[model samples]
Target: MSHLTLIEQSPDPEESKRDGQRHSIADRLRSMGQVRAGAFLLLGATLAALAWANFAHGSYDGFWDTHLTLSVGDLQLDFTLHALVNDALMAIFFFSVGLEVRREFTIGELTTWSRAVVPVVAALAGLTLPALLFVLVSAGSGYEQAWGIVISTDTAFLVGALALIGPKAPGRLRVFLLALAVVDDIGALSIIAIVYTDNFNPAPLLIAAVGLTAVYFTRYLQSARGLVYGSLAVVVWLAFLASGVHPTLAGVAIALLVPVYRPERREVEHALELARTFRQSPSSEYARAAANSLRESISINERLQSSTAPYIAYVVLPLFALANAGVQLNAEILASAARSQVTWGIIVGLVVGKMVGVFGSTALMRLLRVGEFGPGLTLDRLAGGGALSGIGFTISLFIVALAIDDEAVQNEARVGVLIASIIAFLLGAVIFRISDRLHPSEEIGRTLLRPVDPTRDHIFGPVDAPFTLVEYGDFQCGFCLKATGSVEEVHRELGGRLRYVWRHAPLTRFHPNALAAAEAAEAAGRQGKFFEFERSLFSDQEHQLPSHIIRRAQELGLDIERFERDLRSPAVAARVRDDMLDAEAMDITAVPTFFVNGKRHTGPYDAQSLIRALEQSAQEPQPGSSA
Candidate 1:
């Protein structure tokens, strides 16, 4: 039996390209996961709470206020239904926040000082201005202590509201808002710890310290046993509860302490070797060893974040909303709240305060040349984002519960949050819609051609074919390999009507051998064997090493010496480099990126979709050409 490597191996260049794409997709998915589903669930819970509180007031209050108690031997805990949801479930929400914060600082957008500056400064200004505005409005009133209410931005609701704008929504805005909200969360958690504690107990504080220390020590353990971490986390939470500090902070603390480093490269290579061995010789022992090796390759923090994100977003957050968002709404209460300083303070602080603070700070940064705005982030869009930041539902409500013991004042604050959120959403939506209309995003179907050097290019099908399909591809890309069959099918079906062109986009950072492979194809083209060599290169789809390339060249009846010379020639290398430069100029980042009739194909590249795009392009009159 032939020995096969369980995991694919590429030259250093190909390996770099593969790693780049993998990390890119993983990071995108992680960020998207935080915003998408969580937003809808939060909105649904908020709306349901509003309906229940108004339509079924008695039941809503009775159910949420019902007392619940837990006792084990000499230890006892007591909480109302609302308290349990806020204190216990919200802790999980904070844990998720902590995970995001750590990941962002370590690897995500905030990894560098440059990227960190904008969001950190924006968040600080956003937090400060809102509090100041609230204080100014309610300075002499006893409710001035509730200034913390407007300091938070409800990330889920804000992201969800932007989702309504569809995919054309500028990604930079979302990223900026997410980073800002995360920083906002850090500040909010700190305030909750320092300002909200009723009393201090040294015994439980010592116990919490000890438990956290135990968690920190677990980092040295080779095995990441979940039960050990879980037990330690519970102990920490319980200790904090007794310590009179918010128990929810325990979740954040534990999240920050979780190990975030993956196994080293050598360890990963060993795991890959073990996997190959297991594949070659099937056995129970080999399987267990391979599984353990593979599992250790990923960080415990990443694994935990992935596993718990959905529950935090969908379950814990929505439950918190349902428990907290219920506030009685009637004409009499509204009339009274309208006159209350507490209500107007929250309203002005969130709506006007967030807009002025965020936009003003960003504008100032740009004016001072301290930081530049991200692509597609214009002044109007920034204003829109600022307005949306006012949707401070979750943490705002949490602060209300902490800051105010008076039922009437709490109700007034909730009413203000609900009303301000609605107004802010409307204002943001209108501003964004107007901005989008004025500037408009780039659309597909616009011809975007780069000058092609016919002498250096590889062309298949008729040169005068009505429609042309150009592909920027790397030989080591799995997606490009999978796309080969679909491309072949499209070629066969389109026949003389379609022409195909291939351009090099080797992704050299990941795929080490990709540049060499492109050179081999160019060398073959030197002897009128380009198509044959290209077909053979992708045919096997498995072995594309230099030795395999030589074999293919020999099989194509080329003089081995001349072929070898051409492969190493500066001319061949330049040809490949030229294609890459063109790809970069066009901002093509990924392989298998296709262009139909000189216009970028934004739709799926499946055979059916490609055919449809070709046919549509054929029917339409060419730009700047008469029908």
Candidate 2:
């Protein structure tokens, strides 16, 4: 049988040009239509909400306080227009927040310890100090529930404002402001999950756990359907809502549990090669024909990473904002809020607290020898960014609704939010202006990592030989999936002599499921069905893996009970950690990194060269042998 080897596509001008063209089309569409549509929807929603609240109150007696009920026999939910927005619509907002939080941690800025610490610490201080300030002024008041209102920062509003200034603002300032806003969002979500939740309920809590477990396994089994995930997410949200945890947490929970990898890059290339060769060959073959069946699989694999931002940024986030960002303030309410301690506290906390907290924390970190400034950033610039971090509109509003129930108190908090946002904006602008004048320009440095090597090609040996190979791959990487088949072929051909050790080296800046998948595989390995579980990791439709892999083990007559036990065990997670550390130490930047007979080869390999390398190794004399 002629062996098939896979070669991962190195980035070429042709592919880059194609990608750039597609991006241009996407950008044009977004600018010409989506942006305008989104803006109109936002403005319309805001106006509708305001009109609904104020018109009902003014036009009719007791309209704002009128009790609205949704009942199914004995089941009833009773609330006002405000409560409906706060408790129900706001839950979706929080869910979106949760998704953003989960994304940041899993694949964005919060993924690495070093890269994560700066923003996290800044966010922590931004949340903590403002909350402390609010409590200091309003500890025994009716507005104590509104503590989280000051801890948020609105990236969209701030960025939009910056865009209005156009070329007058430096690009570096924009990047800095955006970073601060993203970190502020992280802080805001953490506060919601930790500070807002009431005491937990046992039954609903269990239900939430079960739903989460189901999502995790669904991704593992690779039989994930989007509707199923969406349905389960609803269940999880309802459970959390009933359990006294905010329902929004469920969105993030679902996002985290969704699988993201499309097998290894090697496997895709191998399949493609087999398909191409089989099409050219005259002989009838079963495996070759089966391989040829997956010809369109490569294109499908590319779509995996491309789907994340479009869904989250444009769809989920806008819907959430439309649902949550509305409040009506009549003259009386505004006058009352101006004098209310709750309102004043929120205003002060946001305007003063966030700036002081972020700037102080950054300064403290530098003084304590914890971290140095990032390239293209300085203390002055960071301080200016901190001032802007006080624009805590979206999350702050969500938290305020959760915190205070009284009309007077809510109005007071809203006023505080408005004033604080204005103050923060002006102050941030001033700081930025001063910093720009003081320091005109800065050179941006490259992020720490070497470019991928192109010289080495041989990675895996003969598929039918008895040889053990191990791979460390990132799920977000296209190349890693391309390398999958060579490892599989080695396992198939070598059998017992070839044991592939799978490890997690997820680059959190990209793939959310990489670490989880690695952990899941390790968890399954404990039950001696590692290969089966690994296959499901690739074949399953979900972003992660199915929760039913253990169930499959049960059907295979393995110890299903033991497998379930191991899935939750810390050892599995620990093994994944060890692999992550190994990757870090080896300076392996790209995914699908290989180790064969103590030799390291990065990227995917073709079959012919792999066979040649293995044959040569086999024939070479040992150091101790007399030839």
TM-scores, all models, native as reference: 0.69, 0.55
Off by over 4 Å in 1: 1-35, 166-169, 262-284, 442-627
Q: List, residue by residue over 364-394, the lDDT tens digit for candidate 2.
A: 8878867424323467767777887787766
TM-score of 1: 0.69
Model 1, residue 407: distance off in Å is: 0.6
TM-score attained by model 2: 0.55
Model 1 lDDT per residue over 577-611, tens place:
55664554344546677788777776677898899
- What is the Å distance of residue 361 in model 2 from its true position? 1.3
The local distance difference test score of model 1 is 0.78
Clashes of each: 12, 37
